[model samples]
Target: MIKGINKMLTKSKLEFLVGLGIIILPLQGLAAAAPTEMTKDDWLGKLKAVAPSVICQGFFEDASLKKRMEELKIDNDKCISLIPASFDKCQTQYYSGLPATMNKDSAAKWGHTIGECIGTDFATKYLVSNPQASTSSSSDQTTSSSTPSSTSPSTPSTSPSTPSTSPSTPSTSPSSPISSSTPATSSDSQSTDISRDQWLAQLKTLAPAMICQGFFGDPSLKKKLEDRSIDNTKCVNLIPASFEKCQNELYSNLPTTLNSDSANTWGHKIGECIGTDFAKKYLLPTATPATSTSSQ
Candidate 1:
C-alpha cells in the first residue's frame, strides 16, 4: 500500500510540472509593458479620493531625499514603490501619477490640511524653488495702489506703461467722497459683492500661470480670508479673466508626459493650495508688522 501511494504522488507532481511549463512557453519572449497613460479626469478622481499631500510634502533636494531614505529605512530596491518616486517622475509625467482621480474642491481642502502640518514658510520656499514657477503676487498691494477707480467717471487708459491707477490711490486727496453712484466697471460683474479694494486683494497667484478661487471650497480657508477681509469681488477685479486662462496655461505647461487635465488638476492639487493655504492657516495670523516670526 505504501509503495502504491508513493507512485501516485510522484505521477501527480510530474503532471503539474508539465502543465505549468505548457502555460509559460508562449509568453517568455515578450517584454513587460509600461503603465497606461493616465488622463486628467482619471487623476481628478484619485486626487479627490486620496490626497497626495503626504507624498508631495517635504524637501525634495537630492541630499534631503537621501536623508529621508536613511530615516525611513527605505530599501533602494523598494524606492520605486514609494510615492516619492511619483514626485520624481513629475518631469516625465507632469503630475504625480497618483493624483489623477481627485475631486477639485476636495483637493483644495486637503491641501490646507497638509499646509497645517508644514509651516507656511516651508510652503513658499518649496514653491519659490520650483524651476517652472512665476512671480509671487502682491495682489492687494499692487491692485490697491495700481487699480483704477470703478468709482471714477473717467475711463481707464489701457497702456501698460501708463499704469491703470484706478479710482484712487491712497495719497490722492480727491475732492469727492467715494460715491455709491460711481458707475460699475465691466470687471464689477464678476463678483456679486464686496468693495473693490477687498475684491482685488483676493486675487492670488499660481505658479506657471493659475488664477484660482480654489480656497473658497474650504470653510476654514474662507473664514481666514474673511478675517483678513478677503472677498471674491476684490479677487475678480484684480485678476479679471486671468483665473481660467491661467489655469489652462499652467495645466498645458506641466511636464510633457502628463495629460492636460491631469496637469490642471495637479496644479490645483499641489501648487495653489500649498502656496495659499499655508499662508492662511499657519503664517498670516502670526505675521507681525515688523519681523515675521512664529510663536510657541
Candidate 2:
C-alpha cells in the first residue's frame, strides 16, 4: 500500500510539470514574434506609455538630452513611462536589431540613440509652433521684462516704449526721449529678444562655417554658393558694407545646402563659422557704441 501511494504522488507531479510547460512555451513564442514597426500614432502612443529608463538607460544621467526631453514637456516620470513604447517604436522604425539580446551597456547606447530620434521628432512636430513652452525657465528674465507690471499702466501712459523704472532714464534727461530715438533698425532687431549668452551660444554653433568662408575662404562653399546663383562675395565678405547683406543671403539660402534633411548634418560647421564671422564683424562693431565713438 505504501509503494502504491508513492507511485501515485510521482505520477501527479510529472503531469503538473508537463502542463506548465505547455502553457508557457506558446507565450514565449508569441513574445519572440512580436512586431517591430509602428505607425505615427503607434509611435506617440509608445512614447506616452514607456518608462523613462527604457527611454534612455536611466535618462537623467545624460543632462543635455534629459533637459531637451524635459523641454518637450517630457518630465522624468513621464519620460520613464514613455520609454518602453518609444524604445519599441524606435527599434521598429529606426534601429533594426534585437534590443533584447543587447548587453547592459549596449542596450543603454541603443536606448540613447532611439531617445534622440524621438526627441528630434518631438521638436519638429510640437516645438516649432510652441518654442516658448520649452525655454520658459531660461527666458524668464525676458518674459518678466515684457510683462506688464503694477506700475506698467502709469508708465506706458507717460512713455509708451520705455519702462518707467529703467536706469537709463537718468541719462536721457528731457533732451533725448528714449521713444524719440532713431527709426527701428535692422541692427536693433538683430540684438533685441536674444541675450548676450544666447547670441554667443548661437555664434559658437555657427562659427565653424563663418571661419571657413570668411577667413579660410573655403572654395567648395564658394562654388556651391555660385551654383545656387548666390553672390559668393556676399557670403565671403566680412567688410561692413557687404557683410550683413552677404550673411542675410547665406542664412536665407542655408536650406539649399543639400536639401533640408541633410542640410544640418553637412552645414553645421559652416553655419557655426558664419555665426562667428557675424559676431566678429557685425555684432561686435554695433554692440560697442562707446568704444567706436571714443576711437573716432
Candidate 3:
C-alpha cells in the first residue's frame, strides 16, 4: 500500500513539473519576441547615418534633376554637406519630444521625418535653375567685359559719328519709346508667375514619389520595414493617402502668392510634412493587439 502511494505521489509531482515547464516556455518566448527599445541617442545616430542617402535619393529621383546635378558636378558628398545645423536641431528636437524609449518601428517612423527634412533642405538649396544660370552668367560676364575694353579705343573715332547718329537715335527712341526697364519688369513678372505655377504643379506630381523613394532608399529604414513584414509595394500603395493628408495639412497655409524663393521654402516644408505623415501612418506599428484584446 505504501509503495502504491509513493508511485502515485511521484506521478503527481511529474505532472505538475511538466505543466510548469509548459507555462514557463511560452512566457520566455513572449519576452524574447518583444522588441528591444533604444534610447534617443541611439536613434539619432542611426538616423544621421541613414538620412543622407534618403535625401539624395529623393532629390535626384527626377531624371532631369539628376542630370542637372551631374552637370553641376554635385555628388553625394555635396548632398551630405547640404544638411544644415538647423536640420540637426530639428532632429534633436523631434526625438526629444518622443518617448524616452523607441522601438525599431518608432525609430523608422522618425527616420522618415529626418529624411524629409534633409531632402527639403537639399531641394530648397540646389533644385533651382539659379545655380546653373549663375555659373554660366559669370563666364558670359567675364567675356563681355573684355570685349567692351578691347573695343574702347575705337570709341574716340566714333565720337564724331555718334553725334550725328545720336539725334536720329533719340528721335527713333522717343517715337517707339521702348522703356528697357518696363519690358524687363514685365518679362520678369511673367517668368516668375510661370515658374511659380510650374513649380507648384511639379511639386504636386513629384512629392509623392520623393517621399516614397526616400522612405525605402535608406538601408536602415528598409530593414525596419522588412522586419515588420512591410514590403515596398505596400508602402508605395500608401503614398497617395499619406501625401493627401500632408497636402491638406500644409497646402492651405501657403501664401496667396508664391515666388521662386517662397515656393522652394514651402515645397521643402510640404515634403517634410508628407514624410512625417507617411511614417506615422504606415511605418509605426499599430496597436492592433491591444485593440483586439479590448474588443474581446
> Best TM-score goes to which candidate?
3
Clash counts for all predictions: 24, 24, 0
Candidate 3 local lDDT, 1-296, one digit each (tens): 33332233222111111111111111111112114565655434333332333334323433444565676667655543443332454554454575576554554344334433433433433443235543444344334323312111101111111112222332112111112111211122222322233334445543443444444445555575576665655554655665566567766677765543455456556555555554454445651222222212
How far off is residue 142 in model 3, in Å?
A: 30
Q: Put the candidates in lDDT order, highest first.
A: 3, 2, 1
Prediction 1 TM-score vs. true: 0.19
TM-score between candidate 2 and the true structure:
0.23
Name the regions of candidate 2 deviating beyond 4 angstroms.
1-89, 129-296
TM-scores for all candidates: the values are: 0.19, 0.23, 0.34
- Clash count in backbone of candidate 2: 24
In order, candidate lDDTs are 0.25, 0.29, 0.37
As for lDDT, the candidate ahead, 1 or 3, is 3
lDDT for each residue of candidate 1 in 5-97, tens digit (9 for 90 to 100): 223322212111111111111111100111233333432222221112212211221233334344444433222123222222221333343
- In the range 1-296, model 2's lDDT, one tens digit per residue, is 33332233222121111111111111111112113333323322222222222223223333333454555675644433332332333445643453333323332333334434443332232222243443443243223323222111101111111211222332123222222222211122112132223222233322222232332233443353345333524433332323234345455444321321222232333333334443343334233332232222
Give candidate 3 misplaced runs (Cα > 4 Å).
1-191, 194-201, 287-296
TM-score for predicted model 3 compared with the true structure: 0.34
Model 3 misses residue 97 by how many Å?
A: 51
Badly placed stretches (over 4 Å) of model 1 are: 1-214, 236-253, 256-274, 277-283, 287-296
Task: Identify the leading candidate in terms of lDDT.
Answer: 3
